[model samples]
Target chain A: MKGLAELGEFGLIDHIRARFPQPVAPELGIGDDAALLSPSAGRQVVVSTDLLAEGVHFDPGFGPARLLGRKSLAVNLSDLASMGAIPRWFFLSLAIPAGFSLETIEGFLDGLAEQAAEHNCILAGGDTCGSKGGLTISVTIMGEQRPELILKRSGAQPGDDVWVSGSLGDSALGLKLLMEGVRLGGAHDPLLLRQLDPTPRCELGLKLAEAGLVNAMIDISDGLLADLGHICEQSVCGAEILLGQLPLSPALYTCSSKQPVFPWPLVISGGEDYELCFTAPRCNREAIQKISKTAGIPLTVVGKVTNSRQVQAILPDGTNFQPSASGYTHF
Target chain B: MKGLAELGEFGLIDHIRARFPQPVAPELGIGDDAALLSPSAGRQVVVSTDLLAEGVHFDPGFGPARLLGRKSLAVNLSDLASMGAIPRWFFLSLAIPAGFSLETIEGFLDGLAEQAAEHNCILAGGDTCGSKGGLTISVTIMGEQRPELILKRSGAQPGDDVWVSGSLGDSALGLKLLMEGVRLGGAHDPLLLRQLDPTPRCELGLKLAEAGLVNAMIDISDGLLADLGHICEQSVCGAEILLGQLPLSPALYTCSSKQPVFPWPLVISGGEDYELCFTAPRCNREAIQKISKTAGIPLTVVGKVTNSRQVQAILPDGTNFQPSASGYTHF
Candidate 1:
């Protein structure tokens, strides 16, 4: 394989464009000075950006370039989902090491295009540069929504029902399994799969927003306690979590059974699930449940908003529980 | 005095927000799930992202974090300037080391705010993470322009006159001076200032686009020859450069006079100038000249579009000259 330096910057960009042709051509995308985006009339754009640095975010020994690229965009898309916005366009800025192989770069971009196609998101424009440090992938995603349909964290009120879509702690367990050198044969391992590629709940979010079933929402990138805390802080309320009501996959339960203390820390404080934690009026529980079934996503009632100002966890036996680890933090 | 990790993610974000408050507040900037942008009706949004990696893009000894932050945003703004777009909102993703001080981060954010206020660009959203490598700043800027007035690289005609705003090669000379450990005392040094903070010709670009004088446009970041090559390639045309007519800053000319040979390569192929290189019909020359004066930017006629499909540079003695180097490339 030819080294990256041989192709130079423009040549590498041409190679990338050839490998990842846009399914839906942007008004102005690659090969131009800047990308052009025309928003629908009366639509408000939702924008978010995330940066993933090597060593800090992932271990190269476990994460391949292709999966890394897919996960990077997936994380940003998750932010859009949290806001109840439809994923539309994205921009990528890559800082690749000098000696990195062109083949690896191709694989990364191919994965990005694959993910973009699946979500109908267009890769608008990006910049690539050589890095003296480890590889860094920065992605900015732009989503669109009607102003009235936008979900925010400050909308939750006391007496609202707290719900989370999908199971929690799976991704955190997946990371642990990877660290322990436990490979259950490629993507067949549910834990490893969750860690490497968690799907963003874009459809479910949009449905909830359109139906007005949810008042406040956020994606669970951090652990349940910390993320729920954000809603609590913004909504000016508290929350109470019933430990027995937490939605956990059987695989995670089985993995926890083998541990000495049943891994409650991972269950409560795990990060990167990319599931929605939302609050809605308690009176609309039945409607919310119906919508959950229609969306084919299990909506678990984990807790409820309270007048108290602290988040509390209650064990199965009615004993108070407090988590040891809060959530993931960059700083 | 606290390290970044000590402040935690949310705390650090709060600190950053306090220091870099947006003067022109975005509709829903920062906090919450994502930033909100409401584009004016009938306008197209222009988007561009650029990444600057330490060691590869800049040397730590010469590139301070404050200047680097300003330059990072400036580079992305240049892309918008080339498209004749009005700077609107920006997103920044930073990868900093764990032990990085809050003071240094403050300085960087301060510099960013300074530049954003000058252009009326709002800092809408950003992500910060720990890095194992040197600091990296990735910026994505969104601009707005009416569809008809948008400039593109593929609109040059066969008989269009080529013009470059401001002098070329000053940035290259600045880099040379830095490498030689030459400093003329702070911002007073024209060469140093050019290298550290080259101005993007936004006003001139908007004027040309609105007046419908320029047929094609691009920013000269990757040197005159290579950037001009992009326009020629896109427009499916050729260009002829009269080397004698090339605009050179007095500082650059003085620096070249002391060299073994005139530094034509720097003037023709050096990168990071951030000046506008454009093409217009011969009939619009007077209008362009008048607008350039009003904008207070010198518009130099250095070349013209030709029927041939190659970019040719002619020497003062009427001989063809091919550049030994064609610009900087990451690879």
Candidate 2:
């Protein structure tokens, strides 16, 4: 807690384990050399990783460690949701800058525990060190799903319905307010909540997977249109979206309040919105509605997959529009 | 190779895989989210992680990426050897500073592949990213052995004979030559190779484990005295080692051109000597010799364990002493 070297390797691990949910994996957790988790039946494993750097992905001045931890774990889980897998274990390797306090690490772990418990997952193992400056958190998540039901970005077919769960763009709007020196101050804005703690569409993913309805899936981390493009590229298909029907938080308009910035910017290019963007065949449309009903998530028909290998956006007047940059790039 | 964003995630991974060995562990290898490796039967897994910061661990001015990769993998493998575990799987996560050349990344991966092939180990799964500044490499390794045969730093009993493989101080001396503008040309001086590419004692470890001769095991990562002191503190025992018996490469004296300058400083305080420091019960004295003979590694007896729980260096006259400053500390 005081100095990383002072705790030594095993002592430091014990210190960290005290703050996390003891990974329920049977064979080994932190004491031994490696962890062991049995594979689930009729399922193939799914994995994904994300690295979050201080000062880039987050600003310590306003982005507290808890929120950073929450967001870090959420992003990886969202990836698993894209594959319709059940996230069960995580390995976190954290590099803390010297300026960071033990309290900061604890706050991060606290958020990790809270979010992990929501989906019955646990922190299985990790490596920690003191960096020269600025913190870095790298997390790798392991999940599993039935082979037939495993959703992939490359599985979307022509004529499939493009769908998304719950709301979008709120997280982007929240960032705009933060940049504009708008203090949330406990304001009644779902946009602020979305930014601080965007929910992973785990329930909806499981519901759809169980019902065997979705064709292909991806988490909307890099905004809607850009991610949709990725799905189209992988699936060898194209898509067309009715942009006028883009979902947005009413609170976004209320907060932006006559700033002609066009809500489309937030609705389309907003990253960190961990909602599921998926494609479903027309035959499964009713089943998808039932998934939304069962999971209590709003499933909106956003677009349709097309035969042509190009993505086009249409206005209410059937006008096509083009945007220069597509999505987030972590270079 | 270039910017990770430019290569795209899958492209970068493909580039890496093209260079590394295809894993024989058919169950888990690259391309998956996480790898699943079967540990040796009846053996408990021994796990350890090490972080190599660009500035802290290597000086790019003199450090080759291939050597860095090999050394990074070797350090983790060294930890496994210290625990008498048969090194098996490695998970590497690297963060390279932006604009780092493709040649540099390729060179590093080449070095990693060379070591993996030599050690009979597999590269499982890992994450790669572009950092804001310096590169940071983190490796987690898993080794397995019979649960009861697995050695620990806390298992040495009083009167056990202390032993070490290979030599001490050579790698540190090699590093000094590399950094201090003393390059010996024409593939001479094995010391330089030891410094740049420290060979892990994984084979020696398996021999010791199979022979059931080791009582305690540790890799001499920090100076010999500092590392042995760890065993003393954890096992609640003491050691009295003859200072003059420390191993030194003839090349060191040949390179330095000095009358040893108190060999204790080089042997007791120098670091990066990836040799195995361990203890074996006095009854297995002959077994230790047989292990060394069969494994083709010299095993030099250095000291004996005691009930005192204090570590003392035996002067030529057999008087006891201790080093002034211990070992490496990152914090």
Candidate 3:
């Protein structure tokens, strides 16, 4: 395959346009100056944008280009999922270095296409250009949901039960292993996959939103405590978390038993989990439990909202728990 | 002022969110995982995304940070203008290098706010992160328009008169002077300002769309001939332009007389002019002229659409004209 420079910008655009055909009717997709979409009647639009730089977000040599592509879209989809919106379309802008092979670009797009297809999202419009440095990918995803059903971080009230979907800390631990150059062999290694290709809990979020069970919701991208602090700050409340109730995956436990060092703090402060964390009134606990069973995702009660206006964690032995680092800092 | 590293990502975000306050209702602005917007009744949505890398798009040392900020949003707004949509909201994702001063970022945002305020567009949501290399800014702009009022490049027909708004070639000429190390005095130099801060033709586009006077419309970001070729290709037609009809700015002529280097080819092949080019039926020429007079812009007929599928130019001497270069190539 020819390199990106050899393919030229127009050829690369044509290749991408061919991969994602335009949708029929009311919306005009790619190949135009801009995309035209008819917003669904009675629904509000949800939008989010994210940037993933080469060295800052991911190391190209550490993971497959396909996984990077999946992760790029997955991260933005998680934002929409957190808002309980149904993914519909996305715009991708990429800055590719001169040295990038066309195969690498294809692999990345293939992975992105697979994820978009899973969510029935369409490629609307985008821009591509040469980069003097490493590859930079920026994505803007759009979704739609009923206005009244929209959940916001400011909706949490004191005395509400705090809950989390799925396990935590696996992705942070996976990143640690990868940074230390520990390859667990197969591509399907559970821990490595958790870091490389985290799933957006769209189904669970939709189910919870439709059931009207959650008062407030957020995706756990910046670890548990930091993100919970965001909710507490906005809702003008506090929370008390039981450290023992934090869900740790079997893969994390197995790795910890084999290694001398245990990554305990990662459960609360590590990032890139992409799981849903929400609060609900205790009266709706049974309904949430039924939703968890139907959605096939584990729902764990980790804490309760409080009036103290501070986020504090309690250890299993009844001592105050503190982490060395709060979460990932961009700067 | 301190560098970006000293401000930290969250502090920078807070700084930005403070500048652009959220709208009163019907739309949720920044400080959230995703932004929620209610689309206007009976209006379709329009979207466009663009990326600008530091080295590829601009040289920071040669221009003011405020102009770069203005240009960043201006280019995306031009896309919405080309589609005849009313600008509403935009998402910005920036990758800022560690050494960038806080003043530079604030300057850029100030210029962006100026342009956004002029168009009545709001900053909905965005992501800011650290960059290993130079600054990379990506923007996704959204707008709304009635389905029937939207303009596209695929609507031109044979016998249509091709028209362009405002003058051309001045920006390209100005860029040539700057590249040659010719700083033409103050910040208000007309040529330099034309190149550094081009305006989007939103008013003219809206008037044409509202009057239903144009068969096709496109923004001249990729030069006159190349962008005209886009309309021809999509509309399945050809164009024959008259060289004498090309509108050259007085600044270009003055610079040419002083430099003794005539850049005539730039009139048809240069990029980044951000002017509107369209085609209308011969019968509606009077109406278009009336629109031009009412909108306070110069609308000139530069060519005519043909049944054949080739874009050709005729010199004033009644001979065929061929440009030295077609247009700007991204890669």
The candidate scoring highest on TM-score is 3
Q: Of 1 and 2, which scores higher on lDDT?
A: 1
- Quote the lDDT for B326 in model 2: 70
Report the TM-score of candidate 2, chain A only: 0.93
Residue B23 local lDDT, model 2 = 58
> Residue A275 in candidate 2 has what lDDT?
91
TM of each candidate vs. truth: 0.97, 0.84, 0.98
Which CAPRI category fits model 1?
high
Model 1, native contacts kept: 0.95
Docking class of 3: high
Mark the regions of model 3 whose C-alpha exceeds 4 Å error after superposition: A258-261, B184-188, B258-261
lDDT of 1 by residue, A39-124 (tens): 88898999999998988888767766688778988999899998899998988888988888887887788778888888889887
Interface RMSD of each: 1.1, 4.4, 0.9
All candidates: DockQ: 0.84, 0.25, 0.83
Descending-TM-score candidate ranking: 3, 1, 2
Task: Give the runs in model 1 whose Cα sits over 4 Å from its true position.
Answer: A23-26, A184-188, B22-26, B184-188
Ranking by DockQ: 1, 3, 2
lDDT of 3 at B258: 70
